[model samples]
Target: MKKKLYLLGVFILCVVTLSGCIPTSEKKSDTLGLESTDRYELLIGLNDVGTGKQIMDTQEAIEIIKMKLLRHVSGVTITVSNGYYYVGAFIVDEATLNCVIYGADDESIAAVVNEINSDMNVSVLVSKTPSKYRLITP
Candidate 1:
């Protein structure tokens, strides 16, 4: 009886996984492809996180960046990385932070990334985030 129950559980797990019943934490692009236009993402580093020789307070950096980006652009989405970065969202933490900025046009994205990288404590890595892979999550 125990063996049969274990097999049932395994079968249920496979069904759920194959049927796409599992949920993922990463926010997704729009289902309608409204944000299908060209958008970019900026992977940001700061202080030691920025340049190898630089130094900074992580929280302070996040605040400064949030304010600066907020002023220049209203549509940008910024997520703080826990001293590391992934392609998309994850559970946040209190440790040193990195940043990802996405969902904007080429010119706007370039302008903001340049603005942030111009700061002595920050450096920016530019990459095209395909709208299909990650755009405005619905």
Candidate 2:
């Protein structure tokens, strides 16, 4: 009886100790080519309509846009200089009709794009690794 009890305890101990050593499959991230530490870079193109005229170049406009975008971007920060807006060290260039947004994960990126793209003027290509950016207005 004593020997059986001792063996049972040893087996239990071994099982407990080895359970952590066993390998388990890890879940894939929603973002392609994205590690837990990796962040996304979004190249933003702001346009008013199909005419290709870039508007809303003002502090108020920037504030409004930032407010709109803040929900999707985690810990967003904005700055103004050189006729451009900066979002967490990323650039918002209305002059060139292009901009940059940084530090978004895959879900957040989708949300951000969806919020801005109401009239199908925006399309996203997320199937690629490392991501791609193309904003077309028509």
Candidate 3:
């Protein structure tokens, strides 16, 4: 019986694997297209978790900001603050992106932040001490 069950499981696995081989629609440009082209591109806000205010300008704060932005932009695993990173329903601008950062090295974060900030409408807040930021529509 054990042998039979094992064979059944293997058969099921094979079926499942082979099912994925089925051909799918190759043309889905509309679904994968970028949907952003309007005014009020994006808004970035900073929040100081320690002071309970919106402020980002420290070593620790920068780390958190990068972590959050990377997740949203690159679809990587990341932790975000509550009520933060809210993407609104508006067409984003594809030029001169507006991003939010927290650190003395603003240029460094700008590179990465801008990557996610492009053609997107939202607000972001980055802070230190349990640092984090909130991205929302403005």
Index of the highest-lDDT prediction: 1
Worst ten in a row by lDDT for model 1:
91-100
Ordered from best to worst TM-score, the candidate numbers read 1, 2, 3
The parts of candidate 1 lying over 4 Å away from their true place are 1-33, 48-54, 82-103, 132-138
Top-TM-score candidate index: 1
True-vs-predicted CA distance for residue 34, candidate 1, Å: 3.5
Provide C-alpha RMSD values for all models, in order. 12.7, 13.8, 16.8
Candidate 3 C-alpha RMSD relative to the actual structure: 16.8
Task: Report the C-alpha lDDT of model 2 over 38-78, residue by residue, as the tens digit.
Answer: 33433344445364445555554556556666777754444
Count of clashing pairs, candidate 2:
0
The order of the candidates by lDDT, greatest first, is 1, 2, 3
* Two-way TM-score contest, 1 vs 2, winner: 1
Residue ranges of candidate 3 with Cα displaced over 4 Å: 1-77, 84-104, 128-138
Compared with the true structure, model 1 gives a TM-score of 0.49
Q: State TM-scores per candidate.
A: 0.49, 0.40, 0.21
lDDT of 1 by residue, 1-138 (tens): 999999999999999888797666899656665644444555566645333533657667778777767666555556766444443565322243343444556677667677777764465777775554334455
Which structure is stronger by lDDT: 1 or 2? 1
Query: What global local distance difference test value does model 2 have?
Result: 0.53
